[model samples]
Every structure is written in structure tokens, then in C-alpha cells.
Target: MRVKVEDLYFSYPGKDVLKGINLDLKETDIVCVLGPNGSGKSTLVKCIEGLQPPQSGNIIFDGTNSSKLSRIEIARLIGYVPQSSSQLFSASVFDTVMMGRKPHYSWRCSDDDIDIVADVLEQMGLANLSMNEYNCLSGGQQQRVLIARALAQQPELLLLDEPTSALDIAHQLEVMEIIHNSVHKRGIGVLMVIHDLNLASRYADKIIMMKDGIVFACGAPEEIFTKENIEEVYGVEANIFSHEGILSVIPVRRSDAKLVPESLGIF
Candidate 1:
């Protein structure tokens, strides 16, 4: 699937969140959105998923206008993984993942739904935990279960919000690797909102930097991860190095000499 966002605008009362945002995503590519908080990263993903409608402009998916589609219509083609998972219920992992098949089924789950859930659990290395309570899993294991649930949807587009935010270094890489493999092997487009610059540089086929509700830069990682671009978007001084074809971003210090943008206030 291909997604094209054109001249998109969105706002809350007394606040304009997305300003003429435009982005293109391809099924075989992994795209990462990097920006300071309140830069409209999550809002952009919500607009695309039809969770929050844009105030103006269009989101076209595979040549269809999103404004014409209903929420369930969009959900059939797009799978979203949020930043965190808090399973409050004691539902079995298999049952939780099977819920992703809801869009396809009008009644109870069929044999095909069962097969798909089993397959995804195996792929995520969670087959052993299929019967276990979802709420009992470790953080990393729960994350994988959620991803497996999304995959069970058989979506053409996957939107992930800070997929690794709560993970340790090893689990972070593991999650990213699964996403990367899905893009290459399953031919699904992935748009990830990530704060880790090094992880974005290493895994993303394209990187987009947003500042003040608009795109500051968009290109391949090598093109977008320049020192000046980092400083401009993040308000930080950083050394970006390329080692063995991989880029590593080492932030030296915040640019305290410059005033922080009002929009980025923690409150």
C-alpha cells in the first residue's frame, strides 16, 4: 500500500497541531518520524489511521481518499501499535491476538482466524505463551504479543508509536529487527514515531524530521542525520558518526544558550 498526505492541517481549540504536513509512504519501506515532543508526530499517525480526522486536506491510501472512508474501513487496511501496552485483563495471549481478526469476522472466529493467530504467534516467538495470561508477561514479551496481534490483522500498512520507548537496549533492537524483517519479507509499509536517533538511522529506510508542526527534513538516513539538521530540529549539539555503514548519534549537550520553544513545554 502507498500513503500520500497532502497539505494536511489539524488543530485543537486555540492550537494548530499539524500545519500543511505532507508525507509519502511506500509498502516496502520503513519510515521513521523523529522530532521533539509536541512536534505533531503522534497526531500525524492518528490522522492517517482515521482516529483523529484532519481539519483540512487529504490522506490518500492506495489511491483512495481517506475522508471518504469510515473508521472500520480504514482499520481493515491499517494496523496500529501504540507506544505502550497495559493489559488489565487476564485474557490468554492467543485470545488477545485473535481479537485483531475482528474486522474480518462478522460473527465468531473461524478456522482461518485460528490459523492466522497461530502463525503470527509463531512468527513472534510467542507460541509457547499462547495459553498464558497476557497480563502476566514481561514488558518485552507483552510488546511482542501486541505486535503479533497487529500482524494478525494482515494489514498493508503498520503505524507504530514509539514501539521501543519502554524497552531495554537489547529488546529495543529486537523489536526493531522484527519490524524491519516485516517490511522486507511481508512487503508492508511501516511508519514509526521514534525518539532514538541511532535506532531510526539504523533501521529506517527514510527518516522525517518534524519541528514546530512541519517537516524540517525528509530523506534517507544518511541525508537527514547531518549534525546541522540534528541541532536545528532537536535544539541540541550532537556528533553523528558513521561506522561500518551505520550511523550513531551521540548527543553532547543541550543548546541551553537558546531559548526552548514554547510549544515543547512539558506541561
Candidate 2:
């Protein structure tokens, strides 16, 4: 599915969160939203999902206005994974994942739904945890379960909010790999809000940098992760480099003064 946001504007009672934002997402692209806190990254996802209506402008999904569609209709196209994976109940992993099929079902889950859920559990490496209590798992495992639930939705567009924030390094990479594979294999467009610039540079087909609820820059990782761009958007000094055809970002430490090491004289 394609997503097109044109002159989007959204605001709270006294605060303007999204200001005249515009973006176009294609089915083959993995777009990452890079920004510090309070940059409206989550709000942008909500707007695209039609959860929070934009104060002005239009959100077009696959040539249709998002606001004109029902929540179920929208769910048929977009699947959103929130930053905090929910494990509010003591439900088993299989049951929790089966909930994703709700949008497609009228009353009861069909044989196909069961098969899809089982397949997703295996794909996410949670087959063994199918009967385990969701709340009893590690953070990374819970994250994987949540993502599997989203994948079971069979959506054309996937929106993830900080999908790896709670995971360790290994699990983070694992989850990202699954997401990348899904997008590539299913032709699903993905938009993720991520704080890790290096991961973003490595995995994202396109990057959009936001500052104070507005876009600072938008382009490929190589074009958007320059020293000047990093300093301007993040207020930090960083050295940007390319390693084996992948962009790498390293933050430069700032200090007020240099210190000399003191050594004790021997004998």
C-alpha cells in the first residue's frame, strides 16, 4: 500500500504537534522517523493510522482518504505495533496472537486464522512459547510476540513505534531482521520510529528527521546523516562514515576541558 500525507497539520488545544508535514511512502520502502523526544514521531504514526484525526490536510492510503474509512477498514491495510507491547492479561501467547485476527473475523476464528497464527509464531521464534504466559516472558520475547501479533493481521502497511527500545542488542537485531524480511517478502511498506541512528542508517531505505514536530530533512541515510544534519537535528556532534556499503554514525563526546593523566614515579 502507498501512503501520502499532504500538508498535514495537527494540534492539541494549545500546542501544534504536526505542522504542515508531507510525505510519500511506497510499498518497497522502509521509512524511519528519526527525532528526539517531543518531535511528534508517535503522533505521525497515529495520524497515518487514523487514530487521531489531523486538524488539517489529508492522509491518503492507496488512493483513498483515510478519514473516510472505518477503523476495521483501516486495519485491513495498516498494522501498528506500539512502543510498549501490551501483556495486560495472563493469556497464553497463542491466544494473544490470535487476537490480531479479530479485524478479519465476524464471530469465530476460522481454520485459516489458526494456521496463520501458528505460522507467525514459528516465524517469530515463539513456537515454544505458544502456551507460555505472555507476562512471564523476557522483554525481548514479549516484543517478538507483539510483533507476531501485528504480522498476523495481514496488513499491507506496518507501522512500528520504537520496536527495539526494550530489547537487548541481539534481540534488537533479530526483530529488525524479521521486520525487514516481512517487508521484502510481502511487499509491505514499513514506517518505524527509532532512536538508534546507526540502526536506522543500516536498515532504513529512507529516513525522515524531525525537529519540534516538523521535518528537518528527508532523504537516504547517506544524505540525511551528515555531520551538519546530525548536529542541527539532534544538537550533538557526530562522525558519519560508511563501512562496507553501510552508513555508520558515531557520536562525538563533548567536554569543557581536556585532562592530563597523572603517573606515579617508580622506585
Candidate 3:
């Protein structure tokens, strides 16, 4: 699916969170949103997913205005995987994944739903954990299960919020690889909020950098991941280098030179 956000405006009480935000995401594209805290990355994704509606502006999916669609209709088109959540119930992994089928089924699950869930679990490498209690899984495993549930929705677009948060390096790569494969094989458009610049540079086909509730820059990784842009958006000094078709970001320490007070918050 192709997603286009035009003049998107959102706010929280007295504060504006998204101001004139615009984006274009195409099928099979991996677009990552990068920004500091309070930059409206999460809010923007929530608005797109219909979890929260923008006060003004349009979210268009495949040339249709999202406001014309019902919440369930939108859910069917966009699958959202949130950051982290405490398991409120001890549902089995298979049952949890089956919940994604709700948007498509009104009554008991049919053979197609069962097959879809099973296929998703196998593709996500979660077949062995299907019957396990969801809460008992490790952080990485749980994250993968959440992703699997999203996949079972059969969405044309996937929205992920910090999919690698709290994961070790190996687990982070595992999750990113799953997302990468999904885009290339399933041809789904992915919009993710990622904190790690290096990870975003490595996996994202395009990067959207936001600052102070507006889009600061948006383009291919090489175009947007420059040292000047990094310092301007993130308030950090960093060296950006490429190795074997992947970019690596290394933040320069304050001890290397005299730094301002704001440098303390640099990521």
C-alpha cells in the first residue's frame, strides 16, 4: 500500500506535537522515522494507525482518505506493533497471534484464519513457541511474537514503534532482519520509529528525520545521515562512515573537544 500524509497536524492539550508533517511511503519500502524525545514520532504513527486521529490534515492509503474508512477498516490495512507492554493475560502464543484475525473475522476462526496464523508463526520462526505461554518468553521472543501477531493481520502496511527496544545486539538484528524480509518478500510498506541511527542507516530504505514536531529531512540514508544533519537534529557530533554497503554512526565524545551544556542530552 502507498501511504501519504499531507499537512498532518496533531496536538496534546496546549502543546502541538505534529505540525504540517508530510510523508510518502510505498509498498516494499522500509521507511524509518528518527528523532529525539518528544519529536512526535510515536504520535505520528499513532495517528496513521487510527489509534489517535489528527485534528486536521489527511492520511491517505492507496489514494483513499483514511477519514472515509472505519477504524476496523483501517486496522485491516495497517498493522501496528507497539513498543513494549506488560502481558495482561497468560494467553498462549498461538491464541495471541490469532487475535490479529479479528479485523477479518466476526465469528469463530475459519480454516483460512487458522492457516494464516500458522503460516505467519512458521515464517517468523515462532512455530515452536506457538503453544508456550506468552509471558514466559524472553524479551526478544516476546517482541517476535508481537510482530508475528501483526503479520497475521495480513496488512498492506506495517507500523512498528521501536521494535528493537530493550533487546541485545543479536536480538535487535534478528528483529530487523524479519522486517527486512517482510518488505522484500511480502511487498508490505513499513514505517518504523527507531532510536538507533546505525540500525536505521543499515536497514531503512529511506529515513525521515523529525525535529520539534516537523519533518526536518527525508530521503535515502546517504542523503539524510550526514554529520551536519545529525548534529542539527540530534545535537550530537558524530562520524558517519560506510562499510560494505552499510552505514555506521559513531558519536564523538565530549572529551574530544569542548562541548556545550546541551551536549549532555546527545544520543
Candidate 4:
């Protein structure tokens, strides 16, 4: 699916959240949004999911304005996994995932819905926990279950907010690998907000760096993860390394000097 955000502006009474944001996501691209805390990463995803309305501008889903689509209509096209799983209603793993099929069912779930949910559970490695209480699972396990639920929805666009924040490196790789495979195999577009710069560099096809509720840069990981970009966006001086085509940053010290916009150059 092709999604476009044009001049999107959103705010609360006391503060602004998203400021004239513009983004482009094409079919099957894993786009990761990166920023420090309170940079509107979550708010931007929410606006695209239609969970929150932007004060101005528009979100175009495959050339259709998001405002024209109803809540159920948006849900049918976009599956959203919030930043915190606490916002989700807890149930047995199977039933919780089955809830994703609500958009496709009128009266009740069908055999197809059952099959889809089962397949997704297997894919997410949660088949063994199908009957387990969702709330009883560890944080990583709960995150996997939530992702399985979203996959069961069979949406064209997947919006994830820090889906791997709670997981260890192993679980993070597992979840991101699953999502990467799913995106390419199913030709789905994913917009994810992630904090780990190394993980984002390794998995995301495109990286968007935002600061102070504004997008500071957007490009491939190599272009976006330069020493200057890191110092400017994160306020840290870092040693950036590249190994086997993956870029990783080791923060050595705090950078009190702000990098001048023109002084910073991309490699």
C-alpha cells in the first residue's frame, strides 16, 4: 500500500505534537521512525492509524483521504499495535488474536478467520500458548502475541509503535525478522517507531529521524546514521562503525556543542 502524510500538524491545548510532518511509504517498505523521547514518533503513527486526528493536513491512503474512511474502514486497511500493550484488552491468546478478525466478520468468526489466526500464531511461535492467558505472559511474549493479532488482521498497512522496546536482543531480532519476512512476502507497508539505532539500521529499508516533533532527515540507514546526524539528533558524540553492511553507534560522551546544520555532511 502507498501511504502519504502531507504537512501533518497535530497538537494538544498546551503543546504541539506533530509539526508539519511529511512522509512517504511505498508497498513492502519497512520504514522506521527514530527520535529521542517526546519527538512525536508515537503521535505520528497514531495520526496515520486514524486513532488521533491531526489539527491540519491530510493522510492519504492509496490516494484516498483518511478522513473519508470510517474507523472500521481504516481498521480494515491498517492494523495498529500501540506503544504499550496495556492499552489492549487482555484475553486468552487465541481469543485476543481472534479479535483482529472482527473487521472481516459480520455475525461471528468464520472458518477462514480461525485458520488465519492459527497460521499467524504458528508464524509468531505462539501456537503453544494459544490457550494461555495473555496477561500472564512475559513482556516479550506479550509483544509477540500482539503482533500475531495484528498479522491475523491481514492488513495492507501495519503501524507499530516501539514494538520491540521491551524485548531483549534475541527476541528483538526474532520479532523484526518475522515482520521483515511478512512485509516482503505479503507486500505490506510497515511504519514502525523504534529507539534502537543499530536495530533500525539493520532492519529498516528507510530511516526517518525526527527531533523536537520535526523530521530532521529521511533516507537510507547509511545516509541517516552518520556521525554528524547522530550528534545533531541525539546530542551525543559517538563512534560509528560499519560491519557486514550494518551500521552501529557507540556513544562515547555527551556533546554539549550543537553541530551546525551546514557543518554536518552525509557520507
TM-scores for every predicted model: 0.95, 0.93, 0.95, 0.93
* TM-score comparison, 1 vs 2, better candidate: 1
Give one digit per residue, the lDDT tens place, for model 2 in 1-267: 889999899998999999999998888799999998988999999899888989999999889999889999998888889887655568999998998898999899999999999999998889999999998988898888888888999999999999999888998899899999988988899999999998899899999999988888999998999988888787777888899989898888432113323353221
- Per residue, candidate 1 scores C-alpha lDDT tens digits across 65-160 of 988887777878899998877866679999999988998898899999999999999988898999999888988888898888889988899999
How large is the C-alpha RMSD of every model relative to the true structure? 3.4, 4.8, 2.5, 5.2
Which one is best on lDDT? 3
Q: How many times do residue backbones clash in model 2?
A: 0
Candidate 4 backbone collisions, by pair: none
Q: Give Cα distance to truth, residue 120, candidate 3, Å.
A: 1.1
Pull out the clashing pairs in model 2.
none
Candidate 1 lDDT score relative to the true structure: 0.90
Q: Which candidate would rank higher by lDDT, 2 or 3?
A: 3
- The residue pairs in collision within model 3 are none
> Once superposed on the true structure, which residue ranges of model 2 sit more than 4 Å away at CA?
254-267
Q: What are the lDDT scores of the predictions, listed in order?
A: 0.90, 0.89, 0.92, 0.90
lDDT of 4 by residue, 181-231 (tens): 999888899999999998999999999999988899999999999889999
Worst 10 residues of 3 by lDDT: 253-262
